[model samples]
Target chain A: MDLFIAIFTGTIIAATPLIFAALGELVVEKSGVLNLGIEGMMLVGAAVGVWVSYAGLPMPLAIMSAAAAGALASLLFGVLALTFLTNQYAAGLSLAIFGTGVSAFIGKGFGSAPLDALIPLEIPFLTEIPVIGPLFFNYDPLVYFSFIMFGLISWFLYKTKAGLVVRTIGESPESSHAIGYPVIKIRYLAVMFGGAMAGLGGAYLSLAYTPLWVENMTAGKGWISLALVVFAAWRPARVLFGAWLFGSMTIFQLQGQALGISLPSEVLSSLPYIATIVVLVIISRNWQFLALNFPTSLAKPFRPAE
Target chain B: MRFQIERRVEPSSFMRFAAPVYATFSTLVVGSIMFALLGHNPADTLFAFFITPLMTINGISEWLLKASPLILIGCGLAIGFRANVWNIGAEGQLVIGAVCASGVGLFYPDPESALLLPLMVIAGMAGGMAWAAIPAFLRARMNTNEILVTLMMTYIATLLLSLLVHGPWRDPDGYNYPQTALLPDAALFELFDPMYRLNTSIFITIVAVFAMWFFTERSFFGYKMSVGGAAPLAARYAGFKQSGSIWMGLLISGGVAGIAGMAEAAGPLGQLSAQISPGYGFAAIIVAFIGRLHAVGIVLGGLLLSLLYLGGEAVQLSLGLPSALTSIFQGMLLFFLLASDFLIFYRFTPFPKPIKSGVT
Candidate 1:
């Protein structure tokens, strides 16, 4: 029972970054823009977040600054992909490269200075409950933020009027423009929002999860969150489910070791990546379903009919 | 005076040629400012970064030595890029290739036989193709997105390399380092001056460039793939097999990248390790794009990008700057290139705000 709780807690913590990033991207994709620079933005966020924390700022300020840095990075993507109208994929790739270099540069000195791990939020009355409290109530602030974020995103995406406009724009920017909606402006906002979330996800890494600065520390979590958005079929609720699912896969390495599995550690380390390919294959196998759920105008260059 | 971005009826051929030039100059100018920000004299840093590395004959040799893999991989990636097939897993393919080539070089019974080098080359290309073929088969047969799959595979390949080097392939005599045993004499490429790192494997790169030129500029299959890229609907309507293009696109790029890995192992590296590629696969994407997916352009881009690698080291040595500066420059170059590409399709024309309602 104790082992089960540990695994459960570990999975939620592991999944926090993915949930933040995927939920952010879900919104961006729903608005007819694909910012492939999520990885880049996340790195920028992670680097900036840790730097702020290391410089003796409060953790909340560090986290906010990380989100801002991510949003700024996304704005760079917005200028290239949204305004300059470069090929989104290539532009995003360039951003990834830039973010990686910039982060390494930023992280040059912080490698040796590990920050304290984020303290899990504990509500006094809620702490008395048994398994339920441990599973649902005990986690770092970001994990709980992810839960609130998941609910809020679901509410915003499905139950709001502004959400309909974003969805409409994703479906067809031409028609949305015809209906007098400001397509480019809304998309810029969506892209920036996604960037902020990705940044928070990065902060989760440097401040909450691992609590240290490493070059490209986000690793492929940024990319996996991308896959998660797809796996969730751009649904907000499913982003949480998919995050937990991948989180479990990440935890599998540790569990396997504890259970005396003799697999090489490298092989164990590779499970999440291999699982990504398998999940991508599974979700993408039904071509029509992807076509049906995928954001209609995703990755397509849209310049307002001028 | 106000200017309006007007779409060009025909893409400016002049800008098609000029955009990269413009981007290069832009990167240099921005790079100078960056140097100044870091408290170094901009002019001296630029000189050290760009020119000093190429002044010496040995430095020039190292430049070419670094460029060979890039030019080779860029040529391969350019084909796939032209065909709109994104195969960014060239890094993994390169690693797998080095692993295969080194496997042969390490385990062959007659390690000093001339046959060993040739067999290693073949093994390298085969390994790259095999790694790439996974995505090719998935994308072609199962309709998967190659980008995510390929990127995921890159991580797997890195882990696989780490596994090999750390476990079974650890050098017996070497003290606890994760690397294989070095190859014997006959398995290695012959160096040009014996003092320089430039080796015989450059011939393979030269052949690859010409072969790529021939395939891309003078072949039916190449034309078919371009159609697939430029207008997929038209390609399908014309009955060109999209699956065939997918297979051909991945195989050629993967095969060439593998050869690059083979050359690296045989030439200077002479062993497979965790760091077989220093982001050559990713850097080559920038090379291919900057080269405009053209044969001659890729060669120039490779040289230029190699200079960036050399310059990064040069600055690190002279100014004590961090090595990550090279990546910043590479990223900025691509960003500048993409921004300048706006000129190709649009032009800023003077806007006098003429009324359109009544006249029409």
Candidate 2:
């Protein structure tokens, strides 16, 4: 029972970052702008978030600044991909490279400094309950925020008029433009939002999970979030499930060691990545499902006929 | 004056040629401002970056030594890129290649035999091909996205290398370091000059460049793959097999990248270590694009990128700057290149506005 609770709590904490990043990418992909720079943006966010926290600012301010920094960094992608209509894959790859370099340069000074971990939010009455309370109520604010985000994103994507427009643009930008929607402007906004969420995910890494400013600390979580978006079949609720599933896989190294498993640490460490490939293969085997759910214009550069 | 971007019916050939040069100049101009902001003299730093690295015979040797793997891998990647097969996992393939070559070098009964080196090279190519085949098979058979699969496999390959080095392959005499035993002299490449790192592996790269040129520019299969990439529906209509292209493209890249990995192990490195490459696979993608995926262009691109690596080290030594700045410059160069490529397809013109009477 204790192990179960501990594993469950660990899974929630681990899942939070992916939840934020995957949800953001969901929105971006829905609007037909595939920003492969989520890894880069998250990395920059992690570096900047830790730096800001070390500068003696309040935690909330640091987190907000991280999001802003991510959004700012994503503008480079927007200019090249949306404005100039360059190849999205190449632009996004450059953004990742640039972000990784910039973050390392900026975060070099803050290497030794550690920030205070964000305290888990505890409601006085709710805390006294049994398994449900501890599992559901006892977690950092970001955990709750992740849940709320899933609900809000689901509502926004399915219910709102703006969400329909975003989907319309993704399906066929030409048709959307013919119907008089501003495709480029909407795509720019979607990409920026994705960047901000990716940043927030990075902030969660430094400010909550690890509470330290290590170089390249995000360590492919951004990429995992990308796979989650695909595995979820571009659905917000499924994204939530996929995040938790991957998050559990991430904690297996620690949990297995705790259980006195004799597997080599390197093999244990590779479980998450292996699981990712396996899951991707499994999901992608259903070609019809993927073809149906995938956005028609996901990576295609849209240029209105002049 | 307001400006507008107008799409061209046919891409401008002149702009296609000029864009890279323009991007290079733009990078230098921006790089100067960046260096000045970092409190270094822009001219000296720029010279240190571009010219100082090539001023000596030793420097030229080091330049070629670093460029050998890049040109080899870039040539392979360019072929795949031409087929629209994104094999970004060349780094993983390279690692597996080194591992295989080193395995042979370490375990062979007669390491001094003349056949040992040749066998190691073949093993390396096979290793790379085997690693790449996983993604190729997945994409071809299961209709999986190769980008994600190849990338995931890269992470796995790194871990696999780490496991081997830390466990079974640990050097017996070395004190707790994660690396294999130093390869025998016969297993190593013959150095051109004992004083320099340049070795016989460069001949392999030269041959590879010619082969890549012949395959991509002059071969019928190459034309078929390009047709598939340029217009998939048309290729299908013409009865070109998509699966065949995926397999051939990936296998060719894997084989070349593997040989490059073998060269690294047998040449400057002479042993398998955990960090055999400094993201050569990823950087070679940029090399392929910058070289326009042409054989000759890749050679120039490889030299230019190698210069960047050398210049970064030189600047780090002379100017007290962080080496991370090299990656920054690399990222910037790619960004500028991608941005400038827009000129190939479109022209910027001053936006025509409605002419109003001079009442205002």
Candidate 3:
């Protein structure tokens, strides 16, 4: 029972960053823009988050600054993909490379600087309960933010008219524009929102997860989150579930010995990436399902007919 | 009052070449501003970063030495890029190639065997092809996205290399350093000059460059693959198999990158270590694009990009700047290059052009 609770808690903690990133990407893709620079945005966010914290600001302010930095970074992608009308993939890629360089350049001296990790919040009433309360309630504020975002986003995506507009634009930007929807303007907003959420995810890393600034430290989580979107079939709820699955794969590395597994550490470390490929293969093999759920306009550049 | 972008009846041939030069100029302008922000004399820093490294024979030799791998990989990447096959995992392929070549160099019965170098080169190519084949097979057979898959494979490849070096491949005689023993004499490349690290291995890249140029510019097979990229539906309608080109594009690039890895391991490095590539794979993407996916262009791009690397190292030593400044410049160069390509096919016209539509 203790072990079960521990794994559940660990999975939730691990899934927090993915939740923020994948969910954000869900909205971005729904709005018909594919931003492959999430990894770069996350790194920028992580570095900026740490820098803000080092400025002796409160945790919330630092996170907010990180989100702003990420949004600003996304603007570069927007200008290329939306305005100048470059290939979306190449534009996003350039943004990723740009983010990587800028983050590393700015993060020069903050690598070994002291970090103040976000403390887990334990509600007073929930603290007295046994396994269930500790399992569900005891987590850093970011975890709770992820859960709240999940519900809010689900509601926004399914119940709101603006969400319908975003979805319609994703499916057919021309038709949406014919119907008087501002496709380019809305896409820019969605991309920025995705960037901001990716930033928040980065904040979860440096401000809570490892609470440190390391160059390229996000490793490949940003890419994994992208796979998570495909694995989820662009659904918010499935994104959470997929995040947990990848989270378990990651925890396998930390808990391999505890689980009585003796695989090589390098192999163990690669489990999450391997699992992502496997999931993509399984999910992507169904062409009909993909065509049904995948955004038709995703990654395709839209130039508003002037 | 407003402007409209009109495609030129024919794209200016001059702009096709001028865009890169303009991008380079813009990159320098941005770099100068960045240097000023960092409180350095922009002119001095720029010179130290770009020109100081080529003032001596040793520097020139080292530049070519560093450029060989980049040129080799860049040429390979250019072929794939032309065919719309994004094999960004060349770094991983390079690592695996090095490991495979080193494996042969380390375990061969006759360390001084004359066949070792040839065998190592073959093994390196095969290893790279094998690694790249995963994404190729998946994309061709399963309809998977090669970009993400190749990238994921890169991560896995890095772990695989780490495992080998940390475990079975670690030098047993050497104190706990995470590297292998020095390779045997026959496994290493013969040097062109004793005073320089540049070796006979450059001939491999020289041959590859001409071959690549001929194949991409002149060959029927190359034409078919490019047609596949330029218009997949049209190619399919014309009876070209998409999978064939995908397989070829990936395999050729992977094999070339593998040779580059073998060069590093057998030439200057002479052993496998934790860090083998200085991002030759990723940087080669920029080189391919900057070179306009042409042979001559790639050579120039490779030389220019290699100079950027040397500049990074030089500035770090002479100006007390961080080595990562090179990455910043690289990213900026690509960004500017892609942005400047707007000039190639389109020009701004007055919004009231319809009122004067017959003016031209």
Candidate 4:
């Protein structure tokens, strides 16, 4: 029973960052822009957030700084894909490379420094329950916020007029333009939102998860989150399920080695990545279904005529 | 109201070639500024960056040696990318190829058979093709996004490599190093002289350039791929199977890239290690695009990028600079390429003067 409790606790803590990142990408893709630079943006966020927090700032402020850094990185992507009308795949790739180079250049000075973690907050009524309480109520504020964001995003995407505008733009930018909606502006906002969420996810890793800086520390979680958005079919609730599932896989790999599993540690560590590919295969089995679900204008450049 | 100004002018073919050349030149200029900002002399650094390295015979040999894989992989990737098939996970394919080539070499360590090297080369190509088929199969059968699928596979490859080197394949004599035992001399490629700083694998690279050029420019399959990429609907109507094109394109590139990996392992390292490649897969991407996805063009791009890799190390040692500057310069080149592509496809025309408010 205690073992289950510990693993469950670890899963929630591990998943919070993924939830933050996937939810952000869900919003961005929902508005019809595919930003492949999420990993690079998140890495920058992780490094910058750690640097800020190490310089004696409060945790919340440090996270916001990370978000800003991520947004700044993504803004370049937005400009290239939107204003200049470059290929989204190429532009996003350039952003990823740029972010990596810039972060590595700046990251040389702050290697493996010890830092503070986000303060954990337990709710009063739910804290005393047996299994559910520890997993749900005993997490840090970021975990709770991630849950709220998922619910809020689901509601916003389905229930609000603004959400409708974003979806309409995603479906057909020309028709949305015909109806007097600002397609570029909505896409820009969506991309920024995704960047900010990815940044927060990055911050969670540096500030709360590891509490130390490492080169390329986010590893490939940013990419995984990007894939999760697709796997969830751009739906918010499914994003949560995918994040938690991936999060558990991540924690289990390390835990497996500690528990003396026969398989090599490196194989266990890479299990999450293999699982991601497998899931993609499963989701991709039905071409018609995917075509129907995909946003029509996703990754297409929007150009209006005079 | 939003409006686009189309500055319509037919650019000369020379201009088409000139854009990348200009971007390369501009990147050098901007890179000099970055060096100056980092407290280095533009002239001295530029000298160290380009000239100082080429001055030494050893440096030139190293550059050529490093360039062998870049040229081979870039040529293959150029073919697929030209057809709009994004195989971003070539790095993973390279690793698998290296592992297979190394495995075959290890098994045939004795000098009894000359066919051992040939077998390794074939195994390497097969390994790469197999790895590439994962994404190709998914994309053809299920409508999956190849970009995401390929990228995800890279992570899996890395993990698989780590497992091999760290577990079953770890060298027993070495003190806990995650690597396989060295290949015996019989299984490896040899140059003209032991003391000379050349490897025979470069011969393969030269053959690849001509082969890829012939395939892309002269072959029926190559024409089909280009036509498919340019106009998928028309190609479909004309009886080109979309799935077949995707599969063939990825597998051919993968096979070539895998051969490059084999060359690297047999020609230089002579053993398997945890870190088999240092972004060769990703760098090939830039080389393919900068070459304009043309076979002949990729050779030039390969040599130029190889210089950056060599020069980065040279400058790092001589100027006390970070090695990551190579990555920075590469990233800048790609960014500028995208910008130049805009100039290629679309011309800017000023928005017509707004009609007078009361005019019909």
| Maximum-lDDT candidate | 1
Say which docking band candidate 2 falls in: medium
lDDT of 4 at B171: 87
Candidate ranking (DockQ, best to worst): 1, 2, 3, 4
Q: List, residue by residue over B1-360, the lDDT tens digit for candidate 3.
A: 898798778878898899889989999999999899999999999999999999999999999999999889899888887778989889889988998999999999999899999999999999999989998999899988888888898899889989988898899987878889889999999998889999999999999999999999899989988898889889989998888888998998899888899899999898999888888888888888899999999999999999999999999999989888888888888888888787787788887635545656
Specify the highest-DockQ model's number: 1
Higher-DockQ candidate of 1 and 2: 1
- DockQ for every prediction shown: 0.91, 0.80, 0.77, 0.71
DockQ of 2: 0.80
Across A53-90, the per-residue lDDT of candidate 1 in tens digits comes to 88899889999999999999888788999889999999
- Give the B-chain TM-score of model 2: 0.97
Per-residue lDDT tens digits for candidate 4, residues B148-168, read 778877888788888888888
Going through the candidates in the order shown, the clash numbers are: 0, 0, 0, 6
- Per-residue error for A287 in candidate 1, Å, reads 1.8
RMSD for all candidates, in order, please: 1.4, 2.1, 2.0, 2.6
Off by over 4 Å in 3: B1-4, B350-360
DockQ of 1: 0.91
Model 2 per-residue lDDT at A87:
86
| Reference-based lDDT, each prediction | 0.90, 0.88, 0.89, 0.83
Q: Per-residue alpha-carbon lDDT of model 1 for B142-185, expressed as tens digits?
A: 88888888888889988999999999999988788998888888
Model 2 misses residue B269 by how many Å? 1.4
Q: Kindly report the docking quality category of candidate 4.
A: medium
Give me the displacement of residue A238 in model 1, in angstroms.
1.7
